[model samples]
Target: MALLREREWYAISLRPQGQHRRLRDAVTRAGGHLLALSPLRIVALDGADARSRLRDALAASRCVFTSPNAVTCAARLQALTTSRTIAVGAGTAAALRRHGIANAIAPDRMDSEGVLDLAELQAVAGQRIGLVSGEGGRGLIERSLRERGADVVRANVYRRDVAKFSPTALKRFDALPAATALFVTSAEALDAALGQLDGERRAKLLAFPTVVASERLREACVRSGFGRIVVAASAQPTDLVQAATTLV
Candidate 1:
């Protein structure tokens, strides 16, 4: 936490949800400036069309949830007959428990590749698997499971939509102190930030350092001509703080 205090400014790419207040406090206590990028909205998949497909996937041999939003959506999809539930991370697993669903497993690492690396899934030949996540996420999990002879069915439970900029929205970035490091959790979030910025605001942001969670997002930033893009070792907040400290 002390390390994070060394930075003059920061841009937090968390959606404008109720949970962001805690993160905002953390940044302020660390003595870093924080600009809240528009929150990503989660739309549930509760329509009749989606319910039928989700029912089919729920009958699979096992179920996988890619995010907490997915777990919440899956819980609403009515009765599920899968024998096991695998979550991409501890957070997602807890979300499942919140919805009264048990038998959830979280991988040691919190990513699609890590989930596939689990011993339980490695030999899942001829098994049927259901993947629950938001629409249009990375396809690694689905592709890998299919290659391993598992019939993978993806159930999209939600869609992310960035918040529209209000009159006071730009002030968040404008008030930020100089030399702030922007933290981006995903490539999609980064794209939304860029799209939200005006031409001048975009140039100003390009001058600040950026911390991304994955190599893929870092590469995207580089290709977009961002000045400095640092990839966080992991998605955890501690890892992000360490990376920010290094740059600061």
Candidate 2:
């Protein structure tokens, strides 16, 4: 995505730490300020220990990391037989790389459809594959991979819970003189942020050009009366920035 900011831009990140840093830096370096909105819901993995369960899954199958969160968790899950790793997006692939896991492959697009297009996945059609992600996500990857004859085993590594909004975010929201623009990565984040605000703050936020990462999230914004909702081509920050150009 190209940098196009006619007005001062405020970059919003709804994802976790690994996903946020690089994109936030990219936006800021390109002349936009950042507002971090993390709706992190702690994911309680089944069983007494998350790592042991993840290890069991990894040992039995290849791994598909759905987000940077998944990548971070999978990277930390004590190597279990060196399973194959696939990332849902470039940022996740980068996360795996940063953690010294070099075999991770990312698709051209970040969605489930993009993951199905990988030749490696295509070749492994009857094999068992492990999915690493949080709860409450669309099961597109799991369904699609299963349709292609892959046995998808899900490994819930961590949980997602909403984080408290930073004082900086509140200050920024209060200072906006007119209808502004907002970029978000997930519905959970959007909901969490809105949930944290008072009625006055919600009114101000509702009057903005809103951009979400997926069509599902767009619907969420529409339900909340967001002024305009544009879905990013991919969840990548660069893609979000590109979408921002059209919104502006």
Candidate 3:
């Protein structure tokens, strides 16, 4: 993180495909200023003729976008050609709409549990579905869909690459007070940020009031020794900003 504004203490950002701009804008509109600083980037790897494979996968009976990055990377190769599309979160759904993919199935809750609860996935017998995601996920959705008698396949289109922070950003973060509110979007981001900190920076992270998107993340933060955790409804920028504004 970088650039600590006096009133923007709670504007901490977590990695979910680098979507802090929308959140910061929303917070500013709500009469609060939120600043986000991140050096981590998500990059797509070599997937052996990725464009062709992704094009083929998109033609499945149903397509599930595991994250915003999946939607973005797949869209780069080709427009979604599936009979139906599903997004794992509001951000991913918004990305889909930007690519002209409407009527995407997005659950009220933005997690694997909520995605499984959808009516479209319930009776998926004899269906062929495509899971558009990156590597290193729990595979719950894929397994559940298979259990429902759907032939499931995957197309991993991207991976997260943690970037090194400059000396200036590190100094800025170290200077932030413990009163600064931290926004922990994903468990991975929390882990990465904490791993980067030491001495006073680590101490401040532990003491900072944090806003998370899901109960799962809140539980993770609890284990990581974070106090004053606030869980938002979803990872949407609006939801995140609302939680930060109200809590911090």
Best by lDDT: 3
TM-score per prediction, in order, is 0.85, 0.81, 0.87
91 Cα displacement, candidate 1 (Å): 2.2
TM for candidate 1 is 0.85
Per residue, candidate 3 scores C-alpha lDDT tens digits across 3-66 of 2235544356655445677777766666554545464678875556676567666878888998
TM-score of 2: 0.81
Q: In what order do the candidates fall by lDDT, top score first?
A: 3, 1, 2
Clashes of each: 3, 10, 0
Clashing pairs in 2: 39-162, 40-161, 40-162, 41-160, 41-161, 42-159, 42-160, 42-161, 43-159, 43-160
- Pick out the ten consecutive residues of candidate 3 with the lowest summed lDDT: 1-10
Query: On residues 5-39, what C-alpha lDDT tens digit does candidate 1 reach at each position?
Result: 54375656555344355446556666665566664
lDDT per prediction?
A: 0.73, 0.72, 0.76
- Model 3 spans with C-alpha error above 4 angstroms: 1-10, 16-18, 31-35
Worst 10 residues of 1 by lDDT: 14-23
What lDDT does candidate 1 reach at residue 80?
Answer: 46
Q: Summarize candidate 2's per-residue lDDT along 124-185 as a digit string, tens digits.
A: 67788888787766488888888888878777777776678778767866876543458877
Clashing pairs in 1: 15-39, 15-40, 16-39
Candidate 2 residue 75 C-alpha distance from true site, Å: 2.7
